[model samples]
Target chain A: MIINGKLVVSSSPHIRSVESVQSVMTDVLIALFPAALMAVLLFGYRALITMIIAVLTAMLVEAVWLRKRDIFNDGSAAVTGLLLALILPAAVPWWVVVVGSASAIIIGKQVFGGIGYNIFNPALVGRVILVVSWGGHMAGDIWSTPHPFAFGFDVSTVTGATVLASPEKAVTFSLPEMFIGTIAGSMGETSALALLIGGIWLVYKGHIDYRIPGGFMATVFVLGVVFGGGFYGNHLMTGLFHLVAGGVMIAAIFMATDFVTTPVTPGGRLIFGIGCGLITMLIRLWGTLPEGVTFAILLMNALTPIIDNFTIPRQFGGVNNSA
Target chain B: MKAGNVYLQDLSRGIINENPVFRLLLGMCPVLGVTAFFINGLGMGIAATAVLIASNVVISALKNYIPSQVRIPCFIVVIATFVTIIEMVLQAFQPDLYEALGVFVPLIVVNCVILGRAEAFASKKPLLRSLVDGIAVGIGFTLALGILALVREVFGQGTILGPDPDSAIQLFGAGFEPMGLFGQPAGAFIALGLLLGVVNIIFKKFNIK
Candidate 1:
């Protein structure tokens, strides 16, 4: 190919964008900051400590495993580690953070040939393993009461149930509180507002598509109204409650929209999002678990290849006429 | 090859090159079913090994008499007879293991390993070679089961050898939490996959076919 009288010889991907993996990952990390900051603000220093341990452990594990000195600079491991920590209960032990982070890097990413080759989101994989292995710590009464603006205070004094666990609590708890994240839940998943801020930033940066989160939240809203039992004398409020409560916001916005694990095609992304919403609501309604966002995203991640294969757009005039 | 070298190759091949579980992936029923605990795996392995050896010997000796058309039924009959004998012996002597192994002991009649050897090796080879192959492959299956069970038990239950908490072997300290998922069927698959990957890498490192 010739451009401006200069001959260019290259393989496919002839038109290259300025965006690299590092830049994309960096944008994701930046986008995740609002939730991370909210987590620390709500849960205090323990959340900060968990996030640090997770990110450091993930980077160290990847570097040592790959024997790549500059792996920490790439920002993927940091994103994975931060994401894992975000989904964990703020009261979890430091060792849990380390183990989860290491597993995220090793079994989730490296064992599957690393980075783009991995089928599931590395953070969700780690969180799922942690949840399975240590349910007592990851779920149930592990939720700590948020002491917003009380930074450096030990916020682990009071144990509480997430709004999703006790839907009756949603009747008294206003939607504004849930949006601002003054609730008991996983570190980064409590606040719908923070996640939306990050998600919007990501969308604006062109790092993630809006279709995934839009489809996911829409399905959850529709199903939540139908099945959420009309809390606070209104089914629509209950639907909005489902959107704001538990891990729906974080998962729909951040985890399900992960570049490596989610579908690439526009149609496939929407399908993947809807699938996540369906599984999440199914588990939340009928299954034993209170929240199903992690499992839902992971399950959808496994189907990404199939979704992409089916949703691959045909080339212009490529269809057979005499089939 | 020399007689001793041929025997040695036959022994080592089953352990590594043609490992029934990791290599050929034969007899997955018991491999997945009875490998939740170390003792269960050991018991299942021994029972399956005994049946494998007996069946191999009988099938190899009767190979000339057995017609080709009815070979599979004949092989199954021989294998089932051995499996029944082993099952009865375990029930009489080691009832605890018999109960723990449960359906797996009876299921061994259909385990592909025994019939696989009968069809692939025993019916074609001499009695001595068949006996050696049986022992070697049996040991390989036992080793694979033991390794998988050890990983599952130690990680899943924070114990080894037994499922009972009182008699269980504690490898981890009090603070160390057990990964309960490893005790589930899903864990079996993950462990098997990882072990298989490791085996493949080792084979590649040694340039083994």
Candidate 2:
């Protein structure tokens, strides 16, 4: 079989991994279902609109670029586009999503020699570009409006409260409401519970290395609990709020878990996760932005090379030197 | 290509032919970090130019006296000295520009363009050629900043520079309504990308290939 323009032959043990690109992408989309469902449930048709626009724009850009470069059959761009769309706030304009999708596909993926060669997470790059370009609109924790979809249940008032922009309003969201994913936020970032469910599925499928996400969440929780007065009662609930709210869960489980951009070794992934956690917490605590998980993931993505360099496994019989 | 042509080459090359930020892609930290608006760009560009020129001249003067092994260290000291002076002067006279430039002004000590020019050209060339090269490269750096600011100012905000008085004082009377996308960090990249594309087209058209 011809593979990606290169004709090659390999010896037996040709141990093929079960996770094909298509399978992986499909699995990721499946994994996102829970979060996407929660987002639609809480935020309504607007979230759906945002996700569709983001995904379509990304895919169209990818297809155009592929045509321009005379390459076909690579599905990574589609995966990236879908992933980026799922992460964005539903209220973001189609133009913003288009710009992001184009940037991610052209600059983050294709410009850096495509797919495995990309140094940073394409979704984070797209998100950051969007944030920086439209700071007041994108970064500011403002919601255009929430369109909560309830199947005959009373969600008109339940979802009207802007959980991200107004902390006072968010505070009023009952623990059960927040836990069961009844808050308005980014299309795939509101429901901590749904994300956790998907994360467990991903872990079960062995599609992702668990070290990074586990370490990242651990760091966020530990630091959050410590600063939040030691994880009991209000503190526990608040810490959980930080965990479930915004992009922390989505990023920890999805974006930060990107295989190519993240470190390979267990220790490297651990360090990467810890760094992401620290930066995310710091930004949440001190930075002007409210949802810092995007920035944190982007910042850590930029530092992956340095992390990889330090965390590279020692060659057998090679002497490590530090003078 | 010849000894006589080297000086002319270095000067013109830095200005446009082989611009640091545009062509060589050196000293990006300041170019991106400082070019939020027009005046910020001008201040950073000028500060960088001053340090570049001073460091090049001093390094050229002491090139022969310094040992080959310790040349980098000696160059740092010279560059650092000039940077310190610039920082102090900016702090005393132009606190706003100083704050605007922030750590980037002091960061000139490590700007690869300054040190790179010093080590690559000035250390070997005569003082006059080195000075010319420094000025040219500095001009080139300033030009890149100018382009970045121009794009950023026009797009990011509805007005050029900050306010009317600020623009008049900082941006040499060039003003325009901002476009919103040009002032942010993403604007920086878009500007750089477009500039790079333009540079390539110009280079190809001029048969400078």
| Winning model by lDDT | 1
Provide TM-scores for the models: 0.94, 0.73
TM-scores of chain A in all candidate models: 0.93, 0.84
**Cα lDDT, model 1, residue A243:** 94
Candidate 2 C-alpha lDDT tens digits along B86-145? 999999999988888888888999999999999999899889988999999999999999
Candidate 1 residue runs with Cα over 4 Å from true position? A1-16, A315-323, B204-209
Name the 10 consecutive residues with the lowest summed lDDT in model 2 chain A.
Answer: A152-161
Q: For model 1 chain B, where is the 10-residue window of minimal lDDT?
A: B160-169
Separate clash counts for every candidate: 0, 12
Best by DockQ: 1
Task: Rate residue A31 of model 1 by lDDT.
Answer: 93
